[model samples]
Target: MTVALMWEARAVPGRAAELLAWTEERARELTERPLRRETFRAPQDRVLVITWWDAPYDADLPELPEPADDLTARPVHRWRFESLGSV
Candidate 1:
C-alpha cells in the first residue's frame, strides 16, 4: 500500500517566505526518506507539502512539524490518503 501525507499551513502576514523556508528545512531534516515529496504555494500565504510513502495507510512516517507561533497564522493542517491505482 502507499500513503500520501499532506501538510498545509498559512503564514502570518508578510512571513510567507520565512515559513516556506522553515518548512523546507524541516522536511529535509527528516530521518526517514519518503518515496516522493513536493512543496507548493498558493495565494493568501498558504503552503502545502505532500510526501508519499511506501507503507500501509496507518504506518508511522515522519511529517513536517509546526513552525514557531509567530510564523504561522494558525495551527497546521494535515491529512493522510491511501493511493488508488493511477489511471
Candidate 2:
C-alpha cells in the first residue's frame, strides 16, 4: 500500500526559506527510493514537508541538511499515513 509522511516544523522568523531550500535538495536525493512525491510549503512561520512513498519499507529517507545555527527551534513533528482507498 502507498504511504505518505508529513513533517512539519516552525522556522525562526526568516529561516523558512533556508529550511525549504535545504529540504528540497535533500528530498531530491531520495528519488532512488520508494519516494513517489515530495513538496515543501512555508505558511506564516511554519514549514511543512510532505512525501509520498509507494510502499512501506524499513529504509531511512534522506534527512534535511543542517540549517544555520539558531535558524529553528529543536524538534519537529512528523505524521505517517497509509492510503485507505479514495474517500
Candidate 3:
C-alpha cells in the first residue's frame, strides 16, 4: 500500500517565503527518500507538502518538523492517506 503524507503550516506575516525555503531544505535532508514529493502555497501565507511512499502507514519515515516559533503563526499540521485502486 502506498501512503501519502500531507504536511501544512501557516507562516507569520511576511514569512511565507522563508518558511517555504526552510521546508525545501529539510526535504532535501530526509534520511529516507519518498517515492514522490511536492509542495504548494496558499494565498493566506500557508504552505503544504505532499509525500508519497511505497511503505505502509506504520513504517518509520523522516517527517518534516515544525518551523521555529518566530517563523510560523501556528504549529504545523499533518495527515496521512492510503491510496485506493481505481474501480
The most accurate candidate by TM-score is 1
Superposed by TM-score, candidate 2 places the C-alpha of residue 79 at a distance from the truth, in angstroms, of: 1.1
Candidate 1 residues lying further than 4 Å off, grouped into runs, are: none
Query: Which 10 residues in a row give candidate 2 its minimum summed lDDT?
Result: 57-66
TM-score for each candidate, following the candidate numbering: 0.97, 0.70, 0.94
Please give the ranking of all candidate structures by lDDT, highest first, separated by commas. 1, 3, 2
Ranking by TM-score: 1, 3, 2
Pairing residues by index, what is the TM-score of model 2?
Answer: 0.70
lDDT of 3 by residue, 23-85 (tens): 999999889999999999998799999999998778887889888999999989999988895
Tens digit per residue, CA lDDT, model 1, 3-82: 99999999998898998999999999999999999999999999999999999999989999889999999999999999
The global C-alpha lDDT for each of the candidates, from Candidate 1 onward, is 0.95, 0.67, 0.92
Clashing pairs in 2: none
Name the TM-score of candidate 3. 0.94
Cα lDDT of model 2 by residue, 1-87, tens digit: 677777777777777887777667676776455456566575666777777677664435544454555766656777778878677
